[model samples]
Target chain A: MLWLTFILAGLATTLPRASFIVLGGRVRLPPTLQRALRYAPAAALAAIVVPDVLVVAGDFAPLNPNLAGVSAAVAAALLSRNPWLPFIAGMVALHALRWLPGG
Target chain B: MPSASFRAGAREGFLAFLPLSVGLVPWAMVTGMAMVGAGFTPVQAMGMNFIVFAGTAQLGTLPLIVAGVPLWLIVVTALALNLRFVIFSAAIAPGFRGAALPMRWFAGHLLTDGVFACCLEKMLAVDDSRWRLGYYLAPSIWSWALWQVFTLIGVFAAGVIPKHWSLEFMATIALLMLLVPLARQRPMLVAAAAAGATAVVLRGMPLRLGLIVAIAVGIGAGFAAEHWQDKEEAP
Candidate 1:
């Protein structure tokens, strides 16, 4: 049953994943579809990362470093001329103060 | 397949996963604790390390399995949790156009967030073929191998790792590390910020459904920001 689960999981994951790559060259997606696809990497990432970052201890607590992380992310977002440097600087700032009160 | 390239890619992927262990070990250790709570033996939890590479799905499934949910539900949810991989594979496809099938499959399996971001950076930065692939493979393999091996150690020593050591905290840190080197634009920044905020605001939703809602909102925010910027760029 566990092996079967793995198989099911693998198929579910691999099919959708490989589908676009395998067929992208042959397919002629509309411009709207293409535009949506362009936003995918970031959108999917936001969907996954946001909830994890913000929630603390339980649902209704103070915002905490999760917001700080986002704020830091915004700072990095603004300082986009050299992407990696700002990204690292903001993250360092968060971790340094992550343990502080009222973050 | 060329022996050198095969070894090089696999080696790189494995090493890239190394530092992830420092973060994943605690999470997997918790998974170990969950497995025991759910009546799974430590070995079963350890075995799961090889079988399922996703952190969120592994943590999520523990409860469902414990509750005697159908196997189909657990597997389906895991797949859903990893739905972003579809976007990743799509974006990365163009880079592997002429690569061998086995090579491509290996790359796909190893495409975690860090590895993917690093590889994409390498791909976009370099015009040459040899070093571009090699540089990408270097950190990726390291990270992967570290994750799998430490995952096992976490299972074995689940009891020993300090409770307050903050494994999940470190994972977020590691995640932040990977993103730093990659966020080069307004849309990406807006998307991340909005997504994270949305996730927080929606935290009350059941079964982590709030997460799904937040992600959608964040993605929309990102897309809209990008479109607005494009309009501003028009002469």
Candidate 2:
């Protein structure tokens, strides 16, 4: 089942990416459809990230260490486009929270 | 003789991709480690990496699969996350029109965000078709090679890295950073926030169905924002 899942997953993932190359010569996508596709990455990433970071063990805890850490990271990301800063700030905040007494 | 233009194309592709390749290293490692930590065997993780070759889709599906989500849901989510690649394909298709069928197939498989961006920038600049193969191949080959090597290191080294290192947190932040650049517009930001809020509220849903719901809502919100903006501009 695991291997089958991966195989099917590969097919699902590859077909769309490959579609335009294979079929694009004959068919053209409209411009508006293309523009709307831009929102996908942000939406998809948010869907993956929010649950893992904000909801710990199936409950919302806005004041938790991870959330606090992510707050610091999000601030860094907004300030500078450098990709590494967010992760660094997040790690530093997470560890700092851990070091706090009774945290 | 293989054309001098092809050689030049290849050289340009490699040079252009060098900086992006450096940026990909840490992202690759995080993906690799995340896969191992998610409970995939080294072999399985590498297999997924080889076949899927997409970090975002792979990472997005991991938690769901870990929770034993239905296979169809996982597949749908992966496809949704990868929908942008279809746009990339449309954008780059014209460059490969003259290539043979099998070569075009290979190029399609090799198309990645970084490689596609590099190749498209170069393709648009030069009108000649003779160099397209080399230009496309160079970055694709380099990205695949580097991604495989780094992911392998992460999978094998997973055990040695302590859990307390909090690598999951690192992965989340990395993903968020990736999200930052993409959310340039108000609609995109609204989409992200709506998705996050939806995911948080629906986190208890079985098989991570909440994620699917969130993605739908977010995309709808973005679409609606665009629609409203269009309406406002209509005179």
Candidate 3:
């Protein structure tokens, strides 16, 4: 069953990727729908990320080590184009925050 | 035998992807370790990586799978996380138009966020279809290879890493890197803010249904923001 789930998941991901390419000129997405689709990635990513950082054990906690780390990450990302900078900043901030006395 | 222009394009693509490959290492390793940490055997983890080839969807569905959500629900979640690829495919579809069916299908299957960005940038500057195809494939294959190699390393190293390190959080950080850049524009910023707020409010929803709702709300918010901006700009 697990393997079957993996297969179905693969199909779900690939089908959309293959949709427009395979159908070619036979199909055209409306401009409005295309613009909406452009937001899907950012929105989906935010939906996955926000709760993970803010919610702690079923409670919403505004202040936490995770939030601090993510804030450092966001700052690093804004400052530099290098993807590694933010990743390294986030990990370092996370570890440092966790090590603090009150944390 | 491929032509000289295709070969040149391929070379440029590979070189261009070299710097970006370094960033993928930690992300791929974290993903692999997360899979093993979630109770998947190394073999199972590798199988998932091979078939899925989507880091976001794989990570998004991992917790739900461990919680034993329904299979259909898992598929739906994966699909929703991957909806962005539909836009990517459409953007590059013209380059693949009229190509052989097998080639088109293969290329579409290999499409990814990094590859799409690189391919589109090069496609804008070049007019040759063959060169564009070569440009796309070279980086696509290179990144795919790098991803597999690093993921395998992580799978084996999962046992050595301490659980206290909280390595799964790295996956979240990696995602944040992807998200932060996309949120630079006002409408995108509004979209991300709306989605984040919605997810927090609905965090208690069962089966992670809040994620889907949050994405829907975010897209609507972003579209509304864009429409408003256009109206303000018009006479």
Candidate 4:
């Protein structure tokens, strides 16, 4: 079942990537759809990340360590152009928050 | 033999992508680590790396797989995360028009965000199809190789790493990293904020349906924001 899931997931991504390329000039996506697609990555990523960081064990926790870590990540992202900085900052922040005296 | 322009384009493409390749290392490793940390066997983790070849989708769907959600839902989630590729394909499809079917399929399969941006920029400057193809494939192949190698390292390393480090959170951070940049634009910002808030509020929903709902709400909010921005900008 797990293997099947991976295969299907692969197909899901591949089909879209291949959609226009293989179909050639015969078809075209509507312009409105193209504009909406720009936000798909941001929206989907936020939907995935928010629940993971903001919710702890299936409940919303506004003061969680993960929030602090993500905040640090956002700060790093804005301050530095290097993509690695945010991840490093985020992981360090998460660890620091987790290991803090009472936290 | 390929033409000189193709060779030059390939060299340019590789050099152009070299700097960006460094950033993918940590992201790929975290993805590999997250896969193993999520309880997937090393084999399964590597399989996903090769098969999906998409870091965000792999990370996005890990929790779902761990939660034992329905297969369709996992695929749908992955698809939603990958919808950006459709736009990418559409943008680049013109460059590959009239190319062989297999080559087109192969090129599309290898398409990625970094390669798309780099290749698209080069494609616009040159009219030669061969040069464009070379530019597209050079970074596409290099990035694929780099991603696989790093991800494999992470998969095996996860076996020895302590579980308490919570490495899976790295995946979330990686996703956050991807999200933050896109959020710089107003519409994208609105979309991310709306989606994130919605997902948090709906986190308790069964079958992880909240993710799908949040994505829809986010897209709607982003579209509306874009429309409003256009209206305001118009004289």
Candidate 5:
């Protein structure tokens, strides 16, 4: 059962993940579409990250991790267009907050 | 020449996993620790790493799996968490168009956050092939090795971090940081907001099925919004 599940899940995972690349340039998606595709990864990433940061202790704890993330992320987003800079800034703010009061 | 090229590519691929260690160190360790907390034997936990090959999803699903949530639910959730791989794969597809299938498979396995970003950065920045492979993947190789070792360490320290520190919260922050910069257009905005709302509404659903729903919703929303925006601008 485990093997079967793994195979099925792996196939499901690998196929969509591999679709664009496997189709290999035959899919002539517009440049605008590619630009749109760029947003999907980051957007999907946000969907997973927000709830956890915003909700603390299994309840809504807004001023805590979520604020730290959103604030620093907003800062990073605004200050630098570079990807790595904002990531580091946000991580530093979020994790370092561990030492704060009521944190 | 072919053997040399293949060998060279493999080496670069290995190097790509390296730079990712810093972030991966904590993330993977947390995952391994969670696996331990969930009752998987050490070997099984590590084995899961290779098979699933995603840090966030592993942590997300292990508890549900242990809780005896339906396998379908777990699979769906895992798939949702991993949906970014779709984006990652798509971004690099054009670059790898002329490469062989086996090469693409090998390179695709190296696709992750740090690898994707760093590789794309370096690949796009440089025009020369001489240092291209090394420059593209070395940092990521750093990340991959870091994650594996962190998983080993997290196995030990997993119990140390109290449950309430909300390390998961940090992941959320990391994600917001990752995405906010990319939300530049109407369709992207609609997709992001819709996906986020959907995820929250469906968070209570079985085995993270809400996430899958959210992903589909977000993608569809993005496509629809973009289509509408284009129509409005046209003629």
Candidate 6:
């Protein structure tokens, strides 16, 4: 079942991406769904990021360096628009906080 | 002459995607390391990396897999995370109208955010279908190459590095780089904020079920905001 699930996952991913191309634009999605889908990445990433930073070992860890890292990353992303900048800033922040006294 | 044209198209595509490729490396390596740390065997991690070949989808599904969630949820989460690719497909569909079905399908499968942007930029100017296809292929190939190499390196290194280094944080930062810029629209901002709040609030849910719920609610929030905006603009 695990293997079958993986195959289905692949199909689910590839088919939606391939649908418009293979169908040669035959099927036009409704604008509503398309608009909603536009938010999918933001939602997905936010879901991942929130728990990753806030929840540590099944409890809220407000002081985690991950939170600081994410804040720095958000600023960098907003400022530069260069995708790498946030990552570098966040990584440096995360490590710096870890190395800092009482951080 | 045909091969020469293909080579030139490929070169154009490669250089076009080079900047984005530089950004792709750290994320890919983090993914590779995360896969192993999540208890997947090296072979399994690499297989998923190559076969799925999508960083976002793979990362989206990883936590669910690690938690022994139902297979259906795993598949659904990954697929849901990849829903944006449908837009990429539609946008790029007309350009490949003259190509063969199999080739078109192959191109669609290889699509990524960087490659899609680069391809769209060139599609307007280039009339030759073959050359256009070559342009798409070049970046796809290089991106895949870097992703594979870094992922493998991270997978091997996962064993050597102590968990104290907290390499997992790199994955989170990589995700932020992708996510932050995407919240440009009000609807998208609402979706992101809602998703973050839901995930953090429901962090107690078992098997990371809250993440899926958060995604669904986030999309709902975005959809609602858009509908509201449309109604406001209608009059």
Top-DockQ candidate index: 3
Every candidate's lDDT:
0.58, 0.77, 0.82, 0.81, 0.64, 0.77
Docking band of candidate 1: acceptable
Q: For model 1, how does the per-residue alpha-carbon lDDT over B36-63 read when each residue is reduced to its tens digit?
A: 5556566676666556666666776767
Return the top candidate by lDDT. 3
- lDDT, candidate 5, equals 0.64
Looking at the true structure's interface, with contacts defined as alpha carbon pairs within 8 Å between chains A and B, what fraction does model 4 recover?
A: 0.74
lDDT of 6 by residue, B1-235 (tens): 5577778888888887786577677778778888887888888888888678888778767778778888877877777667657766776676676788898888878887657745665763688877787788889888889999999998988888888877667777766665655677788889998998898998777546787789778989988987888899896
Query: Which model is ahead, 2 or 4, in terms of lDDT?
Result: 4
DockQ of each: 0.29, 0.53, 0.63, 0.59, 0.38, 0.53
Which is the winner by TM-score between candidate 5 and candidate 6? 6
Error of 6 at B193 (Å): 2.9
Q: Of the candidates numbered 2 and 3, which has the greater TM-score value?
A: 3
Q: A2-101 in candidate 6: lDDT tens per residue? A: 4565577677678878878788857766766655655666776788788888888978887888889889988987888576787778878998998999
Q: How much does candidate 5 score in TM-score?
A: 0.70
Expressed as tens digits, the lDDT of each residue in A50-89 for candidate 5 is 5665565556556875577568867876787554565566
Give the alpha carbon lDDT tens digit for every residue of B1-235 in model 2: 7699888888888987775465466667878988888899899999989988888788878888899989999998788667657767876777776777778778888877667644675664576676877888888899889989988988887888888978767767766665665577778888888888898888877656677678767877787787888899899
Choose 2 or 5, whichever is better by DockQ. 2
Candidate 6 lDDT for residue B1: 54
What TM-score goes with each of the models? 0.71, 0.74, 0.85, 0.79, 0.70, 0.72
The alpha-carbon lDDT assigned to residue B144 of candidate 6 equals: 80
For candidate 3, write residues B1-235 as lDDT tens digits.
9878778888888887665556667778988998998999989999999999888788879998999989999998888777767777876676765477888888888888766744665664578877777888898888888889989999999999998887777777776776765788899899999989998998888657787789889989999999999999999
DockQ of 1: 0.29
Q: What is the lDDT of residue B222 in candidate 6?
A: 85
Candidates sorted by TM-score, descending order? Answer: 3, 4, 2, 6, 1, 5
Q: Tens digit of lDDT per residue, candidate 4, span A30-79? A: 76775665566677778878888877877778798888888998898888
